[model samples]
Target: MSALPWMQHLIVVPVLLPLLVGALLIPVAQNRHGFKFAASAVSGVLLWLLSLALLGMADGGHWPDGIGVYLASNWAAPFGIALMVDRLSALMLVLTSTIALAALVFGARRWDRVGVHFHSLFQFLLMGLNGAFLTNDLFNLFVFFEVMLAASYGLVLHGYNLRRIQAGMQYVAVNLVASLLFLIGVSLIYGATGTLNIADLTLRVAALGPQDTYLLRIGASVLALAFLTKGAMWPLGFWLPTTYAAASPPVAAMLVLMTKVGVYALLRVWLAVFGDAAGELEGFGLAALSVGGMATLLFGAVGMLASQDGGRMAGYGAIISSGTLLAVLGHSGSAVLASGLYYLIGSTLAMAAFMLLIELTERIRPPGAALLAITMEAFAIEDKPEDPVGVGIPGTLAFLGLSFVACALVISGMPPLSGFVAKFSLFHALLAMPGRVPPATWLLIALMLLAGLAAIIALMRLGVRTFWASGAVTPPRLQISEVLPVGGLVALCVALTLQAGAVFDYLSRTVDGLARSGSYTERVLGEPPVMRPAGGEVAR
Candidate 1:
C-alpha cells in the first residue's frame, strides 16, 4: 500500500485532541475566563467537526464494510491496543460533541464562574467519552471508563453545594462498586480466553469447549450486571433521579449522555460476543434484558407521575428513554433496531434540553407553591378570576410556555415530532415481523403505550402547575448563551422529525452493518500495520 495521508489518522483525533487541550487548560488561571472559554469552545468545535467527518466516512462507505481501525504504536491487533469506529460508534461521537458543546456554552454563562476548573473537567469528560467510543480492547475500555468517571466526579460536584455533595457521594460509591464488578468480570474472561481484545473475544467464544463455555457465560453475566447498573435498568437505577436532580442543569444535561454510554457498550459487546455467531452463547441474556427493560419502563413512568419537581421528572424521563433502548436491543430485529437508534437520538436531545429548561422554569414557580397548590386541589378550593376575561401572557412567559410544550410533546411521544415518528416506526416494525408477534411482544407494546400516556399525564400536571396554577410570575431575565443551547437542542429534534425518512434509512443501513459482525471482525483483525515514510518500511 502507498503511504497513508495525515487525514487517514483522523480516527485518533477525537481522542487525542481533547486529551491535549484538556491538559493544556489545566495550568491556565481561573481569572482568565475568556481564554479558558475560547480554548474549550474551539476544542468543542473541532471535536464536532471531526466527529462529522468520521460519521461521513463511516456512512460514506469509503472503508471496507464502513469500518475504520487504528492500531496504536504500529502494533498488530489482538496483541496491541486498537481503536475502531463503525456507524454506531461514530454516531455516538457526534452526539457527545453536540451535548458537550451545549453544556459548555450553558455552563460558561454562570455555572463556570461559580466553580473552579470547570472548563478543564468538561474537556476531560469529552476526552473520556470519545476514548470510550473508540477503544477496541476490553482493558483499554476500562481505562477510558475510569477517565470518564473521574472527570464526572468533579463535574457532578462542580458547584459544591450540600445537595450536590450528598448526591455526588452516592454517585461515587455506586460507581466504585460497578467498577469492581467490571474488573472481576474482565479478569474471569481474560483468565478463560487468554485475550482481552473485544474482536478477539468473539473468535475465542466461538471456538470455546464445553468446559470454557460455562465460565464464559458466568463472566459475561457478571459484566452485564455492571453495564446494567450504569444503564439505569429497573432496580439498579435508583441513583439516577437524585443525582440528576441535584447536579447543575448543564451537568445534568451531560449526564444524560453518560447513561447512554452503558447502553452503547451493552449493544456493542453483547452483539459481538453473544449473537448468532457465537454458537453456544448465541441469544444469551437477551430474555433477561427484555424483562429488565420492561420493568424499568414501568418504574420510570410511575416515578414521573409521582414526582412534582421538574428536575426529578426529567430524571425519570431519562430512565424511560434508557428502558426503551434496552427493550428494543433485547428484541433483536433489524427494523426495530433502526427505529430504536432514531428514538435514542431524538429522546436524548429532548431530554437534555428539558434538563436545561428546568432551571429556567423553576424561577417562575415560587417555593411552597407546589405544596400549597396540591393542598388547594385536595380541598376543592379555587383561585378564580372574578371578571373571567382572557389574559395575554408576557413574551418571556410565552417563550417558556411554548418550549415547555415542545419538550413535553417530544418526551411523551406525541405526534408531529421526532419522538412520535420514532415510536411509530418502532411499533410498526414490531408488528410487521414475518411470523406472528410473540405474546411477550404484545405485552411490551401495551407497556410502551401506557408509558407514553403516563409521561403525558405527568408532564401535563407539571405544565398546569408551573405555567398556570401559580398566578403571574415576573419573567426571569434570560441570557443568549443559555437560551440558544436549549433552543438549538429543541430545533434539532424538530429537524429530526422533518427528516425522518432520510435518518431512518441511514440508521437502517447502520443496523444492517451491525448485524453482520463478521465484517467488523474481518476489518479490525485483518487491518495491516501502519506504513512508514521511508522506503518500504512499515511500522511493524
Candidate 2:
C-alpha cells in the first residue's frame, strides 16, 4: 500500500518545487529576467517529468491500494494533512505542468519583460495549481485555492494597463466573494461531519442521519455554487471574456486551466462524497447542473457571435468548453464522464493554443487601420493577373494563416482534429445509454452544435478581416520562443487525435477507478479495501 521509499517523497515535490523556486526567484533574481526565466523553465520541466512518473506509477499498478496517499510528517488521514494521487489527480498534474511549461516558454519571448516578478508569480501559480490537484483534504484545497487566486491576481494585472487593472479589480472582487463562500461551506461541512478530509467525508456522509444529511447537502450545495462561479457558469461568468481578453496572451493561455481546476474539484467532490454510495442522498442536484451547463453554453454561443475582437472570441470559446464538460459531468455516466475527460484535455489544449494564436494573428493588422477597409480588400473579386505570380502566398502570411485555420478547426470541432473526435465520442456515449435519451441531452447536443457553428462564423469573420481583407500587411516579428510554444500545443492536439484510442483506454480506466469511490475512501482511510475484480461494480 505504500510507495517505494524514493518515490514516496515525489508526491510533495510538484508543489514544493514551484513554491521554493518562486520564493527563491523573488529574492535572488528580482529584476533579473534571464535568471528568473531559467529557474522557472527548469522547474516547470521537472514538474512535468515528475507528474509523468507519478502517472506511470499509478497506471502501472505499483500501489496495492489503488491510490497513493501521502501523509505529511507521517500524520494519518482524517487527522493530519494528506496529499493523494490517483489516476485523475495524476492526469491533472501532468496536464497543468505541460500547459504551464508551454505558457512559460511563450512568455519568455516578451511578456516576462513587461512587468516585475513575472516568473515568481507564474511559479506561484503553478504551485497553487499543483497543490489544488494533489491535496486530499478540504481545508488544504481552500488554502491552495487561495494561493492560486492570489498569484493569478498579480498575473492578471502584470502589464498594469488601464483595462487590465479594471478587469483585474472585478476579477478580484468576484473571487473574493467566492472564496468567502468556500470557507463558509467548508466550515459548515466540517461542523456537520466533524472532519475536513474528503475521503473521511465520503465515509461519514454515507452514514449520516436524515437531519445531518440535509445539512451536508446544504453545505455541499454552497460549495458547488462557489465552484460553479469559478467554472464560469452562465450569469456568474460575465467577467471571463473581458478578463481573458484584457490579459496578455501567455497569461490568458495559462488562465484557461484555472476553470478546469473548478471542474476537477466538482468532479472529485461530487463523485467521492455525494455519489450513489450516499444511499438515500444519491443523485442530488443533477437537474440543476444540467440546466446550468446548457444555459452557459447558450450564453457562450451568443457571446461568441457578438464578439468583434479575436481575443474575446477565444475567451468565449473557453466558456463553451467549460459548459460542455459540466453538461457531460451532469449526465453522471461513466462512459460519458470518460469522454468528458478526454474532451477536457483536448479543449484545454486547443483553447490555450487559440489564445496564443489570437495575439499573433491580431498583430498582423497595421495599427490605426479600419477593419471595414480590410474586409473589402479581402473579399474583393478580381481577374487573374496578367503576369504569373512568383509565389502563391507570402511565407509569413502562410504560417499565420495555417495556424489560424488549425485554431478555427479545433475550436469549432471540425473534422479530422482532436476536437471533432472528442465531440463524436461525447455524442456516442450519450446515445449509447439505455432507454430513451433525455430531452436535456438532445438540448445539449443542439446547443453544442450551434455553439460550434457560431464559433465558425465568428472566427471566419475575424480571420477574413484580419488576414485576407487587410491591405499591405506587414507580418509581426515572431521569435522562435514564441512560435515553438504555439506549435507545440497545436501539435499536442493533433497527437491526441491520432492516439485517441490509447488516450480513451486510459481515461476509461480512470473513470472505472473513480467510480469505485469506496476503494478511494478505504485507501485514504488507511484501511486498504479489498480490490474488486475488473467489471464488478460501477459507481452510479
Candidate 3:
C-alpha cells in the first residue's frame, strides 16, 4: 500500500518544479527571450516526464490506499497538509503538461513577443494547475484555484487587444465572485464538520447528525455553485465563449484545460465527500448535476450552431466537452465515468489544437475576403459544405486544412477517430448499467447525439467557408514552431484512437478507485511522519 521511497520524493515535484521555475523566470531580462524559452521549455518537458512517472507509479498500484501521498511538511494528514497523486490526478498532470508545452511552443513563434512576462505567467499557471490537481484538501484547492485565475487573468489579456481587454475584465470579475463564493462555502463546510480535508470530510459526512447534515447539504450546494461557474455549466458560464473567443490562441487552448480544472475539482470533491458510503448524504446532488449538465449540453450545442467565428465555435466545443463529462459524472456510474474520462482526453486535445489552428487559418483569407467572410458570418449566412477534392493549396493550406478536418472529425464524434470511440464507450457503459436506464439518462443520451450533430453541421460549415470558398488564394506562411503543437495535439487524438482499448482499461481502473475510495482514510491518516533521506534513501 506504500509507494517506493523515490516515488514519495517525486510526488511533490510537479508542484515545486513549476513554482521554482516560474519564480526564476520573473527576474530574467525581457530581452533574454531565447533563454526564457529554453528554460520554460525544459521545465515543461520535465514536469511532463515527472507526471508520466507518477502516472506509472499510480497505475502500477504502488500505493492505491496511499495514492502516493507526499505529506508535505513531513507530517500526516488532518494534522499537517498532504499532497496526493492518484491515477486520476496523474492523468490530468500529463494532459496539462502536453497541452501547456504545445501552447508554450505555439506562442514562442509570435504571441510571446506581444507582451513581457508571458513565459513567467505561463509557468505560474502550470504550477497552479498541477498544485490544484495534487492537493487533497478544500483550503489548498482554493489557494491553487486563485493562483490559476491570477495567471490566467494576465494570459487572457496577453496581446492586449480591445476584445481581450473587454473579455478579460468579464472573466476576472466573474471568477472573483466565484472565488468569494468558494471561500464562503468552504467556511460553511468547515464550520459544520470542523474539517476541510477531503478524505476526512467523507468520514465526517457519514457521522453527521440530522441538523449538521442539513447544513452540510447547503454548504455543499453553495460550493458546487462556485465550481459549476468555473466549469462553464450554462447560465453561469455566459462568460466562457466570449472570453475564449477573444483571448490569444495558446492561452485559449490552455483555458480549455483550465475549464476542466473546475470540472476536475468538482468531481474530486463530490466523489471524495459524498460517495455512497456517506450516510444520509449519499448521492446528495446527483439529480441536480444531471439536470444542469443536460442543460449545459443543450446550450453548448446551440452556441456552436449559432457561432460565426472559429474561436467562438472552439469555445463552444469546450463547453460541450464539459457538459458531457459532467453528465457522466453525475450519473455516478463507474463504467460511464471511465468512458467519459476517455472522451475528456480526446475532446480536450482536439479543442486545444483547434484553438491554435484558428489563428493560423485566419490568415489564409485576403483582407477583402476576410472582411467579407466576417460580414457574411455576421448575417448568419454560410456557404454549403464543399468537398476539398478539387481546391488545393499544397503547403500551409494542406496542413491547416487537414488539421481543421481532424479537429472537426474528433469534436463532432465522427467515425474512425477517438471521439467516436469515446462516445461509443460512453453509450455502451450507459446502456450496460445493471438496471433500466433512468429517464434523465435517456435525455442525456439524446442530447449527446444531438450535440454531436450540431458540432458536425457547425464545424463543417465553418471549414468549407475557410478552406473551400477560395479559388486561388495565396497560402499564408506558417512557422514550424506554430505548426508542431497543433499537429502534435491532433496526433495525440490519433493515438487515443489507435490505443483505445488500452487507454480505456487504464481509465477504468482509475475510476474504480473512486468507486471504492474508503481506503483513502485508512492509509493517509495512518502514514508515519516522513524523515529526511540519508545516503540516497528515505528515512521514515
Candidate 2's residue-wise lDDT over 1-540, tens digit each? 332366777889999999999888887745678888998999998999999999998888977545787778656777888899999999999899888998899889689998889998998999999999999888999999999999999999997899999999999999999999899899889878999898888788878887888888888888988898889988888889999999998899988999889889988988888787878767677768888888889999999999888778988998999998888788644559988999899889989988888888877888755456444546884533344367467666777788788878888898889889988888988988888998877888999999999999998888877875566678788888878888899889989999999999999889989999888887888833233346664222
As for lDDT, the candidate ahead, 1 or 3, is 1
In candidate 2, stretches whose alpha carbon ends up further than 4 angstroms from where it belongs are 1-4, 373-389, 527-540
Poorest lDDT segment (10 consecutive residues) of candidate 2: 531-540
Q: What is the overall TM-score of model 3 with all chains considered together? A: 0.95
Best by TM-score: 1
Q: What is the lDDT of residue 248 in candidate 3?
A: 94
**Error of model 2, residue 92, in angstroms:** 0.9
**lDDT of all predictions:** 0.88, 0.86, 0.88
- Candidate 3, residues 251-342, lDDT tens digits: the string is 99999999999899988988878887787787889778888888899999999999988889988999999999888888754557888889
**TM-score for each of the candidates:** 0.97, 0.94, 0.95
Best by lDDT: 1
lDDT for model 3 comes to 0.88
Q: TM-score for model 1? A: 0.97
Instruction: Put down candidate 1 lDDT per residue, 1-540, tens digits, no spaces.
Output: 564557669999998888888899899988999899999999999999999999999999778899999888878899988899989999999999999899889887788878888888888889889998999888888889889999999999998999999999999999999899889988888878999888888888889888788888888888888898889999999999999999998899999999999998888888888867899788789889999999999999999989888888988999999998898778754448889999999999999999999998888888878897788877989897455368666777788888888889899999989889988888998898889889888888888888899999999988988877887567888888988888899989999999998998889889989888888888888887766756657643
